[model samples]
Target chain A: MDADKHFIVGVFDDEEVLLKGIGKIRGNGVKIHDVYSPFPVHGIDDALSIKRSRLPIAAFMFGMTGTALALLMQIWMLGYDWPMIIGGKNHASLPPFIPVTFELTVLLAALGMVGTFFIASDMKPYKWPRQFDLRSTEDKHVMAIDLAINSGKTKDELRSLLRDSGASEVNEKSFE
Target chain B: MQVASSLREALITGGKTVKDVSHDISRHVENKPTKLWWAAMAISVAVMAYGFYCLCYLLWEGVGVWGLNKTVGWAWDITNFVWWVGIGHAGTLISAILLLFRQRWRMSINRAAEAMTIFAVICAATFPFAHMGRLWLGFYWVFPLPNTWGSLWANFNSPLLWDVFAISTYFTVSLVFWYMGLIPDFAVIRDRAVVQGAKIRAQVYNALSFGWQGGAKTWMRYESVALILAGLSTPLVLSVHTIVSMDFATSVIPGWHTTIFPPYFVAGAIFSGFAMVLTLLLITRKVFKLEDYITIYHIELMNIIIIITGSIVGIAYITELFIAWYSGVEYEGYAFYNRVSGPFAWSYWSMMTCNVISPQLFWVKKIRTSLVATFVLSIVVNIGMWFERFVIIVTSLHRDYIPSSWTMFSPTMYDIGEYLFTFGFFFTAFLLFAKFFPVINMAEVKSIVKVASLEKKENASH
Candidate 1:
């Protein structure tokens, strides 16, 4: 295995332990590469100091785009291009246009946010994700420490630190 | 950590650990289809085949094959359209509305409910498309696309045009929401498949999950995206049925032209939607042996929603009558009077009894909690809601100001067949989903188990 690709992985069976272990492991001068679990462990982000996601901001921008596009489309189509009188109403009535506008706004916001999430998280079809431990997707919470990042400590030192911080098992992983 | 009040009832019972949740939910997906599942699939497929035949024959014969006359142009088609759309509401309501309220009980049931919504919307869209009689050629005409026909855009001022946008957007957004939730659960299945040496299952689920790794950063983004989607869907679901109601409310017809249609229709949609949810969940829990996850307490809470919405619908019905009488408008008065005592008074009374009266029985703790009663009453509520739509469309149109064009509307065999086709499609899709996909939101449900289970907390502390 490449020296740079070496990692010390800790497996946790309990969410509470994993959460507290995040802080304890980091406190011992070990930088966590990532923590993987079967479900979203509440407050794990704060524990890992992961920044809050900007997905909602992206959703809002997309929603605004939808609103503008919808209004422009309706106004351009009914007002300028081929206006027809249906209910003795105006050519481009705003009230009648609201439903479609609302629908499009929601549509764009949802789809856009989902797309952004996939991109931001690097999630996509056929993308083989790096599973430090497959059990991380099951009952175990797996925390990975990059050996290169924590070169100050030996492998044995990191492994014992993980075990002391509530890890049931500590394993070494490396990738080319 | 979320700590449920000591006094609160446990959301997940049967003393489930994280491993048990994964095992219990994924086993259904990982294992071969049970004999009951095969039997259900066979029946649904047979119905779908028959319905497909009817749809083909209808397409070949044209709109004249149905009993649509000049007066009652909108009968079963519109009724079924509204009914299916209304049924679609509960999924988003549970996933979105209840989510905003932070109701943890929704975790177990939202997956199936949202799937039902997708299927129901597909069923709803069938009516308007099939009613067009030449859907193959004219389907694209609904969209405001730049066409060859002189750039003659679809009428923006028309509710019919607005419906096209509304339903399509609603379906797309709901599908995205449902699929997003399924990703993490799919990852769970995929990981289990790897351990069990099920290569095909692992590959399929991995692709379906879009290679979700469940990393802390990814999960943080996933949660934010989910929350925003839920916020978007809440208003989107309400707007969908409100626009559907506008199809009638915006019209000048005596019975149809009521300002109360929007709120009333939305309430009725939720009422019928909850009934449908109850109908599906009760069977799902029993068939999948998920009794512990979807406990009787969940049923009781759902029943309470049914009571609230049902009473609202009942009040709307009465208020419509009172307003007709109070307005002193002969046409409006005659419309309500005819609805009560007219030739089709049977449907009106059926609507009242089934939707208004039957759900009220849920007030009795015994009836509401009993699986048999909820199952039976849920079907009753759906049938009544169907009649409610039928009575509104057919009765209102059957008697116009001019007696010459006024005529009774009756459904041909094709009408009934088209409806069966939708049922077949819905059940077939749902069964396939239940068999293959995780029927419960395993990820979400797992998140709550530690907090929701008092025993687990106690055990942990010990």
Candidate 2:
């Protein structure tokens, strides 16, 4: 592993219980490393106070880029380079340009946004991720709290806090 | 939190927990392939092999091996192309369009629909590529790449060129959107594999999943990107079939030159698309024992869409006929007349019955909800849509302005083989998808597990 961290992880079977537990844990001002759920639990993001994403803005910019590139390529090709008069239609026209323009616009937007998402999520193909709890991907939701960052509470205190809040299992996890 | 209410139906039934949803959906992936899976795959490969043989012979013997003649240039190949493209449309509509609309019922079906979209596009693309006798050069020529022939650019005005761009764009977008949706679910499967001590499965799914940490921050971005992609794909879906329709509508041919082709083709695309989805889902649901997730509610909702689109197609057909007679052009009028009374009258009636009359059966509650009825009608609708394309392409061309060049088309064995080959290819790909990946969008299904209304009720009661 390129990086390592010590963490206290809590696993909960029920989403409702998990939500309540998240609220309780976050209420104490304990910094949460991350919570992994099999599904996107409603209100979990708000509970964790995660920041709103800026991906939509990225998508718009990418889309604009696509539109500009499409128009530029078409104008360069049809208007200046190898312009032909077929069926008496205009060599550099607007209607015929729309389809290709639309296609390129969509293609670039999709590709660009996906690229942006991978960057934003730190979801590179080569990165080896640390797993806090394997069951987090199965039936349980996992909440991992970094032990090294929190100086106020002892490990036992956080472990009891996890147990009191309905965690099925509270375990210490480390990635080396 | 969601209770199955009269007004707001639960998207997933059996009141499944998130784990149960994961387990239920992932069971197929973790276990070895079933006997039925093997049998179906075997048949698909055999059919595909035959189709491949036909394609090889086509390459060897040339385009003349098919029944295409001077007058009727585009026949079974283009018709199959359009048919398959139309089938691909329902997938995007289910995923992108329905997502935009917030139709929760799409959760269970969207995965299969999107997969169908990819496979169907693959099938649809084979025609135009193979139709080019010089498949090698013609494929490259269709693209607007700058080459040694620097001054020679692809004709911007050509619908075929537009189609080349449209199909590829549609394929790429759909692939991204579908794969993006799969990432989180892949992580879920990966976690399970690790627990089971399956080293290879864990590593493969781990990499495949992009090491998704399920962080709230990551999910938010995943969601935002999904919405944006959906927005991009919605217009894209409409444009794709519209460009396909333009291949005919832009022409001077009597039956083909109609302003209504875009909406008509789009409507028919959705119609056949839903039918094909239904056809496949019915088999998939039963074979996989996924009745709880893919409930009658989902089937009926899809059936309702089929009815609506089918009627739109029917109205378009009548409207085209009305315009043909209403337009006083002899060529257009005779073209409509020829479709009804030509050598292809059977194809025309089949189109009418399958596309129009048959889907009307879906209007009935019992028939629409009935699995057998939906399955048969779905296949029937597809057959109708195919013949509909045949009637439009062949009828107009067989007896156009130049009567001397008018000729009836009869498909050679290779044409039938090529069409069967697509069926083989489509099923083989789809079955492999079903076997390997989570068929239902597990993450999405988990999202809808708690109904908003039920949550509201619980809060109020509290």
Candidate 3:
């Protein structure tokens, strides 16, 4: 279980209303904890002010590793380990290495990116996710605002902000 | 007719809300097994059992049980391998390529296509296994692993080795792409299970979903990963079949040698792959009642690709003939001549008609748009592609360089049995997958619906 934290959760019936609610609430300087939607709402990340993911840099680094490893593995195995000339071609030919090199590059890139993603997202097999709203997956979008972030605001003030900003219902949420 | 054609054609028919999309797609997995599911499963199992018996008998009897001799070592087995592998190309084309192109229509169909790629690859894999008659040590011998034998290594020179690496890598990548895409949909189901008060269901789906919170940060990461994977797989789809083509082109076996094979094989692979997708989806769309999700637009667009690739394949076929004649090499000339007017002329003509001539009918708007016509043509195209492989493998090999060894080759019951084994394995695996997982890409589908919904909202506000 994660460290318990108090959250002001707003449930929304529609994505448009949710988007507008996010804008109004953010304009009022209330920090958002997280928004959960059944689907990826277009422009929601911009609305949430989330930084763009750095996954491509990770993918490129992994791909280079794979390329370097593939070349070394092939050269070492064929040229140094036990050189044998088949079909009158050189043992360490560049032409033949391209296919294997390409494959290893792709394999490492895909695996590394997924591994990085799982780690970055803090997805552990043992940890259960805090479910803010059961309807979040089915149809509704749920936005949770952390109360601890805005110490100046009381619970009532945040609740009213949620309601005025198009929250169908405002409820207190806690996560372990 | 023109007015009817001009009628607003949305990729998604039947106005469905975001919730409806989730409910409709997830119901297959969340609900009880329908009788159709049971019937299909029972039939698939029965066929699979028979196929399993065939494999066991094949192992017991050895490779000799199939029709193989000095002349034709690769006939039905490799043909089936190439065919199944080719059939799998459409899945990647639909998922990765379409995604890269920003085709919104791809959203609804990609899940099933990616699943098809996995299943088809699985089916393709059996041929290699069957080719390894000594199944126990076959893996150790063929697979490149450090052995106790001094200075032992697989031949990097061999295209076969390249194939081993390519197919395995393709399988791994496609699998990651497919499973990663499933995470969000699985989360959707998990949340639904929670609401239904099904504790066991919720717990199971949550574990499967990897604690997906559907946060904006997660979605951003999710979208980026999908794009990168699509980029990775696009080259993969092309490379795999190119390497497969090299298996023939690298050889000097008369008809086997050609510069045209890589692009030719790639086109043929996509051509056959789309046909297989259409064949399966036509039945699946009806059975699952997913007409709205898998609309006529999707079907027609796929058919247009078929026509284009089919034309490319047709040109390749002609080029092969022209080159064989122009080279003036006796073996190559005889190879092409023998195909058109040889012992296996029936198979050659079948290939031409099915692969080339029939698909041209798609130029007619009505023919391509008709579901029944599309279904029938899809099957026809598959048969044509199967014959195309047979023509390449068997026809080429049946007549050897040495006149004395030249002989006819045909599939024994074991060969048919081996093929049936893959069909059973593929369908059984797919049917179970359909029942257990979100058959539609719920998240992607919802994005499209979400956009449409937003547009509707703006109109109302104005």
- Number of the top DockQ candidate: 1
In model 2, the runs with Cα more than 4 Å from the true position are: A1-4, B1-6, B452-462
Local accuracy of candidate 1 as per-residue lDDT tens digits, B115-190: 9999999999988988899997665578887777887888888888888898999999999999999999999999
Best by TM-score: 1
After superposition, candidate 3 runs with Cα above 4 Å error:
A1-4, B1-8, B453-462
TM of each candidate vs. truth: 0.98, 0.96, 0.96
**TM-score of the first chain in candidate 1 relative to the native first chain:** 0.97
lDDT of 2 by residue, B197-306 (tens): 99888888888889887876787778888999999999999999999999999999999999999999999999999999999999999999999899998999999999
- Share of native C-alpha contacts between chains A and B (below 8 angstroms) recovered by candidate 2: 0.78
Query: Tens digits of per-residue lDDT for model 3 on B367-386?
Result: 99999999999999999999
| Clashes per model (N, Cα, C within 3 A) | 0, 0, 1
Question: What CAPRI grade goes to candidate 1?
Answer: high
Q: List the residue pairs that clash in candidate 3.
A: A2-A176
Model 3, chain B: what is the TM-score? 0.96
Q: Is the docking of candidate 2 incorrect, acceptable, medium or high quality?
A: medium
**Between candidates 1 and 3, the DockQ winner:** 1
